[model samples]
Target chain A: MRIFEYMGKELFSRFGLRVPKGRVVTTAYEAAWVATEIGSVAIKAQVLSGKRGKGGGIKFADTSAEAKKAARELLGMKIEGHTVEKLLIEEKLHIDREFYLSVTIDGGAKKPVIIASSQGGMDIEEVPENKIVKVHLDVELGIHPFIARNIVRRLGLDVGSRQGKELLNIILAAYKIFQEKDAILVEINPLVFCGEKIIAADAKVIIDSEALFRQKDIPYIEEQTEAEKLAQDLGISYVELEGDIAVMANGAGITMSTLDIIQRYGGAPADFMDVGGGTDMEATAKALEILLAKDPKVIFINIFGGITRCDDVAGAFAKVKKEHGIPVPVVIRLVGTNQEEGRRILREQGIEAYTNMDEAAAKAVELAALVPAGSL
Target chain B: MAIIVDQNTRVMVQGITGKQGSFHTRQMLAYGTKVVAGVAPGKGGSKFEDIPVYDTVRAVLQEHQVDASVIFIPAAFAKDAVLEALEAGIGTVVVITEHIPVQDEMEFIAYAQRKKAVLIGPNTFGIVSSGKCKIGIPPNQFFMPGPVGMVSRSGTLTYEIAGNLIAAGFGQSTAVGMGGDRIVGLTFIDVLKLFEADPETKAVVLIGEIGGNAEEEASVYIKEMTKPVVAYIAGKSAPPEKRMGHAGAIIRRGKGTYEGKVKALAEAGALVAEMPSEVPEMIRKLLA
Candidate 1:
């Protein structure tokens, strides 16, 4: 889950790392009041996307009036498709220099990697390899003080200097957050040197979703759509798309392959829904109900059941058609365990099911094209 | 002959009394798997379908000479269960549990490597050596002993392609699901190496999706194999930054794109199928 900048700063402060005092506000009046108290604040929009500075999501305000004006413009503004809902009003610091530091999992290496650079406040991908120092850390032996000090030294900072020691402390704190919080990524961009103190000017942290059960104390903001939230509650996976044909399958790969075949046959998918393994008739009905809410011209149900029985999926289609009355055409391809019973159940409802995925996908595309665009 | 498990391979079940564990144990036994012992912590001194249940892997080790361990423990206590098996000197461990914390997986997977053991998956459907042994949860009806070898990252897709292959008069020698997590214990290359050295396997089918560079890295090894490899990659129309059910099946930072994986596999001289249905025909022409 992606943590908001304000929450990440809160975590940073909790880990004994220095951060500019900030207050998160949702209204212009609150922003102005915070600016009056903090004096000369930087108004940063709270969104999940990066490059916020280039997108005009970050602005400076010297007075209360300027703070209100900036907050008014930033609120409800769209940056990379995320509407700014809250503003972080923080005390502005006079920075001498900026540096980049982060710790993330290297999937190929199967280990956590630490990346540090002298250049900051920009896309780390755009930075040249010569300017960045990357190190892989062993999970067995965590980041030691000497390991962090060496990373600081490689960035051309004096280990004996006060700023260097502060930078080392920040790096150690970032690693601590990465391990202690079950975080997948913990980044501090532009670790600014303000006179005598080094502080994390910006923070980004992404915690492991599977570890959320144990890390319950960390605050998380929901960034899912209503349909997505419904699917999550139902224990299914759903991704909304802009197309006329709705797709549902038993697993991720087969669902994606179903979408791929639909596009191959000249049809666009309205959404991606996976009922998952060992799904029962009730969960399948709930998944179909969520898909029908999109109002696609055609719905494609593909099942290559291993543990999931075909009869359960077909039973869902039958139950939904009988109760809610499906207005759109549904093309289903049922195979694997109990396929005969599944086909018999659908046939009793006056619906014919295909046995081949290609034929079923082509039929769905053909049916979708018969409907006029935007008619649904 | 199969690469991993066969009729003679002795297997042990962890969390054997749980719902999923007990259920698949019956299936594996019906398929003629030599399931010797089971570990269920407190349910010890009992028998799950006549297979002796012990308190721990160490207790089971004192009785039976087990070769591989299949785990169905929940994600919270999965780390301890796997460590117990590894500490008991089990060579092959297949973890079928899903939603394990990635940190826990990293620790156990690294330890498995240091012990020189083959860790199959932390979130997989397991492996089947067609008609001889069944480890995880793939339906046994679709498998038959033949010359083709299969490996996939997804479970149902493996069954989908396996059914198609059987329809086309081909059966698998072994099919391995490497799991759907971002960090898995085994990779495409590791299994491909085994199939390459196996004498009974004539051809291989590699099933991949939009994820890390596992497929792209496997392509380099495919170029050196003397046997033919037919590949199919799913999620061609998937949107970027969206986790499509699997934790690992997203395109992040402009990496692990469908086009890149397809290009690498094609360049390595493997016949890449555009759809799952096309795989059988490609294998027919190659093997014929």
Candidate 2:
């Protein structure tokens, strides 16, 4: 969940980070008004992915007329699959110097790494390798004040200037904001300097998805439909497809392979629902219910246990059968630790478990063909 | 010495009251897995499949000497649940929750290593052995306790391959889904080592897909293994950008590309199959 510059600034401002005073507007008139107030402005389009400039999503405007024109052109433009419906008319700043500062997750390291550079404003990827500075920190160590000061010093910010401490303080504050928000990435691409004061000319923040439950205060995107929301609420993630078989399973890899197997077996998965690891009977039952709700032609529960037990899933099937009728035919293929016990439980409960995924999948397709098509 | 779990395993479920947890918990109990207890915070003192439900893993361990735990806690609390399970002296913790924050995973994985408790997955299907108790979610319909040992990065891929094995008249000894998350407790090589040593496991099935260097890394282990190993790698037709599949299966940064993994595995002297449908036949041919 990436936040645009307008939202990023709100967080940056709280940390005493400096930025060129500006306003965001959706209309041409408002854009012209901001242009008049700020004198000259940078007419930037708001889109999700990076490299907005290379995508021709950004333009500079000198006069109010030029700003309005640029904003109008950008407001309806599409950049990298995202529509630039909004424009950020920022006041043009007098940048004496610019530097980079960022906090991002290093995927391989599984930890947050703070990335900084003496060179900024231009593409960070193109920046000279020697100019960048990086620091990897443990989640427990956190971003302390000393670390911020050290980062500034390494960037040679002390160049005998009073702005050094101010820059350090702003960057430090931003780091705090980053941690508080559970941000996956908080970056100030160009921390601008004008005379003795430094300001955040640009800020980018990406919220970690798993932290969404904890981030009650942050606004969330409401793009998903009601059914999608319900599926997410159930803890298992699902994506609807055009296939006839509804696939439900335990892991991302499992979910994907379910879809692929369905395709290879001459069937398509109507949807993908991953109950995730360590699911219980109720969750598994609900996952099955959710698949049923999708009104799939056939339900295929493909599970390959590594830590999760098959007997537990069998119990979920029995429970679901007891609680609610399985509206559609189900083909369950589960194998992993405690598999025999899981099979016995399923057998005792009168729910059949398919030892072979291919056999079960074929059964699902055969069963799906038995049912007539109905709109969901 | 089947990988991950065998008959001696004492299993416990952490969110047993929930639909998914309860269902899988019963499966573990039914599989003769020595399931001692279940844990669901507010549902303490209750029972799931005749197993006592405790508030915490400590209580479960105190009541019954359990060594391994299977977690079905919600994504938000998955990391904490796994940590507590490890702290409770559960040597092996299976986390079946997905979408756990990367930060939570790093801390838990690092700590689990220090605590000497193996955490299988934040997103995994679970582990299983034929005729023994099972944990997590794996289909038991196809398994008949044969000589094949299986490990996979993708759950369905494992299922498809294992199905081929079953169809080919070979049953699985123990099948482990090593998880699809970027960081997991165990690796393909780790499970391969167990399979190589297991007397019952005459041949091994390794299911991999495009994404991550796991397959390439496991190739080295395949070379050292004494038994014949059959391999299958997917993602040959996956789009360059995330293939909209497994969270970790989406190849990026050119680290675990499909071509790279398949090439590496084939080079390491393991018999590699082309597709899921081709797996069982390839294994049978190699064994013969």
Candidate 3:
């Protein structure tokens, strides 16, 4: 879960971090007022994804009139497919130096690792190796004063300076927030030093998905917070790998088997999604919205029935095909419990069903191979 | 020698008074798991499935002398419940509850490691010790004591593989659903080591999904194992850049994906089965 800048800054303040004074605005009028109050503000479009500057999501304006214009243009602009719904206008800082600091879960190590660097405002990834210092911490130890002191020293901060002391406090605060929020990553990209004061210029936080349940406010913006929303939305649970053939199966097992079969037939799967055990007509139709939207060359539905009735799955496909037309070629693999009824329904409707996973995979691969290279 | 739980393992139930806790508690009981005691705050003196219920894990442990626990607590209470169980000297703790906070899990996993205790899942189905016992929510009908040891991150995939193994005239010594959470207690390598040491288990089946380097890390261990290991990775049919499935399954930039793990495992000499269903057959061949 991604929390917006304003909320994150509020958290920063609570943790005794020095965050630059900022106010969020929803409309251009509000942005203009904010610019007037802040004086020489940085107007930034609220985007959840990283690299907002690259997407022209941030603009600096000297006057309120300029701030309004920038906000108006950014209000409805789409940066990285997310429409800008809000704008955060912040007070500009006169900075002498910028530093990088973040704490993230290192999944491989099964512990939280703190990364602090002298390189700031540059993507932490692109920062030179010498500029970046990584600190591996055992979670059992939690946040120790010695580790915090080491990070401050590694960044080459002048411990005697007031700004250095302030920056150290902010860094420790960020780590506390990371631990408290169950954050996958909490980054203060440019902890700026402006006239003997350390302030957070920009903040980014990525919360852990596993921790969302305890963090109640996190789900208010969730894609599925209610049963009604889930019932209406089409959600296929599977990872999307780099492949060309798309597979739709009833269970996770059959979906994986379908992927294997496709690979064996000299083709790669475009996606892996299971419609779950015995889905509804609307759900099947929604699955198409998710699967076909990927624009795959071909689709193969592998349904091995048990609690998941085959004819019900077939009926879902038939309904989806009738309502929303699918552009790509498709293959149906119906087996197990409702094999007879499902096969008969498909055959009667002039759609073919294969009992063998290999044959269906082969046909899907063949169809995918026929797609023009440029089209694919 | 399967991982985590095996035939001789004794199990206790945590949060046994709640609805889900009671229901799965019955299922675990029916599966022949030696569920000696139950724990629920102020719900002691009650009997669930004819098993003694205590107010706390400490009380349950003192009376029952049980070392392992199956947690049926809700997500909100999951962290504290796990902490209580671990603090009570439980040897292996299986947290069946999903949605544990990552911060809570980070603390729990670290604390458990420090205590030298095995914590299985934060979002797990639990562990099955073949026909003798089940300390979690796996359907009892699919398992029979045999030579193969299985460990998986996915619940249903574990069931499907175990079912196929049953159909193939093979059975399992133990099947551990390590849980699909990113901060789960036991990694694939942790369970693989136990399987390697188990005497009853001749081979191991590892069901891996597309995400994380857990499988790759386990593959390194598989090469050192004396037993044959069959491996299968899900998400072969995954679309590019889609973050579906479990949170751990998300594809990062240049790390923890299906393709990289596959190459690593294949090089480690584990026969990679692309299809989930074929894993049991592949294991059978490897064991033969």
Candidate 4:
């Protein structure tokens, strides 16, 4: 999950890392009050997205009136589809130099990697590979002092200088946060040197979603759509897409492949929903309801049940069809465990089910094409 | 003649008395797997399905000559469970548990490599040697004994493709689910090497999705293999930055794109299928 800048800074402060003093506020009045206390402030929109500055989600103010004006403009502003609900009013820094540092998981290497560069406050991807230094660390032997020192020196910092020592300590602290907090990414873009002090100008911390059960104290912002939240509650996975056919399947791979097949047959998928393994009648019915809410031209249900039973899924389609009556053209390809019984259940509801995935997908695409544009 | 599990492979069930454990245990047993023992802490000295249940793997090791152990422990305690199995000197460990912390997985995967052991998955459906042994929770009816070896990152998709292959008169020698997590124990290259050496496997099918560079990396290895490989990648139409069910199934920063993976596989001489249904026919043509 993506942590807000203020929250990430709070975590960094807990690890003895220096950060500009700031307070998150939801109202312009509070923003003005914070600016009054801090003298000059940088009003940053607290949304979980990058390039906020380029998107006009960030502004600077030297006076209380200017802070209030900036806050009024930023609050409720949309940047990259995220509404600005909170603003971090922080003391602006006078930086002598800017550098980049981060600790993130190297998925291909299967290890934690430290990425440091002399360039800062820009997309690290655009930076030339020669300017960036990456070091993969062993989980067993964490970030030793020498490794941190070497990283600092490689970025052109003298090991004996006080600035290098401070940067090294910050790097060590970032690694500590990455390990102790179970974070997938801990980035401090533009670790600025202001006269005699170094401070993290920006904090981007993303914790491992699977490790959230252990990191109970971390605050989570509700960013999921209504359908996504419902799916999460049902122990299923749902991702909304822009298409005419709604796709549902028993596994992530099969669901994605089902979408691929629909696209192959000149049809677009409206959403991706996986009912998950071992989904029973009620969850399947709920999944159907969620897909129907998307109001696609066609509802394609594909099940290659392994732990999930076809009969149970068919029972769900039957129950939903009887209760509310499915309004869309429903195409199902049910196979695997108890498939004959599943087909029987669907047949009783006057719903013909296909056994072959290709044929079923083609039929759904054909049905979807029959519906005129804006007919729904 | 399979690569990993065979008829002679002795298996043990971790968390044997739990809901998922006992249920799949019966399925494994029904499929003719040589399940030798079970481990459910505090349920030691008990018998589940007449298989002696011990509290720990070390205790179970005293009696049973186990070749592999399949775990069904929950995510919270999964680390210790995997460590226990590994420390007790089990050569092969298959973790069926999903939602295990990636840190714990990194630790165990590194440890497994250090010990020179084969660890299957932290979130996988498990491996199946057709007509011989079944380790995880795949439907037994879908598999048939034949010559095609399959490896996939997804579970039911493996079953779907396997069913299609069976319909085309192509049975699998062994179908392995390399797990769905970002950091899995085995990679496409690892399993591809195994299938390359196994004489029973005449052709290979690799099912990959949009995530990481696993398939692109595997494409490099596919060029070196003499065996025929048919590849089908999912998530061609999937949008970027959205986690499509699996944690690892997302495209970030324009990396791990479908086009990149498909082009790499096709350029490396693997027959890349446009759809899952096309995979069986591709395998047939290659084998023919």
Q: What are the candidates' C-alpha RMSDs?
A: 1.4, 6.8, 5.0, 1.3
Ranking by TM-score: 4, 1, 3, 2
The local lDDT score (0 to 100) that residue B115 gets in candidate 3 is 84
Instruction: Give a tens-digit lDDT track for model 2, residues B1-288.
Output: 566678888788888899878777766666677888889898889887677899988777777888788888888888889889888778989888877876688788878877888778768777888888678777556566888888887665676566667777988898887787766778787788888888888888888877767788888878888998888776554554343446566665356776788788888888877556677787778677
| Candidate 3 lDDT by residue in tens digits, B1-288 | 455665577888888888778878887777777778989889898988789999988787667778698888887788898899888789999898866777778888888888899988877767888877788776667778899888887766676677778788889898888877776778888788888888988888888887668888888888888888888887664544345556666665446677888898899888888666567668666766
Q: In model 4, how large is the Cα lDDT of residue A195?
A: 91
> Which regions of candidate 3 deviate over 4 angstroms?
A28-39, A63-69, A128-130, A136-141, A209-219, A222-228, A231-376, B1-3, B17-19, B165-170, B236-242, B277-288
State how far residue A93 of model 1 sits from its true place (Å).
3.0
Lowest-lDDT window of 10 residues in candidate 4 chain B?
B108-117
Q: After superposition, how far is residue A74 of candidate 2 from its true place, in Å?
A: 0.6
Query: Which candidate do you rate higher for DockQ, 1 or 3?
Result: 1
Please give the TM-score that candidate 3 achieves against the real structure.
0.81
State the lDDT of candidate 3 residue by residue for A214-278, as single tens digits: 66654334433243243234645655556777777865545665676788788988766777654
Residues A1-376 of candidate 2 have per-residue lDDT tens digits of: 6778778888787767777788889999999999988888888887775778789877788899998888888897888667787888898888888888888765445566788887988877778888888887776667777887888789886734587778778767877877888786788878888777787888788776668888887777544456666777876676666677888777665566556666766777787677766677777777777777766777888777655668778888888877887777778887776889888887776668886666787788888777876634
What CAPRI grade goes to candidate 4? high
For each of the candidates, give the backbone clash count: 0, 68, 8, 0
> Chain A TM-score of model 2 versus the true structure?
0.72
Please, what is the whole-model Cα lDDT of each candidate in the order they appear?
0.92, 0.77, 0.77, 0.92
DockQ winner between candidates 2 and 3:
3
lDDT of 2 at A42: 89
Worst 10 residues of 3 chain A by lDDT: A223-232
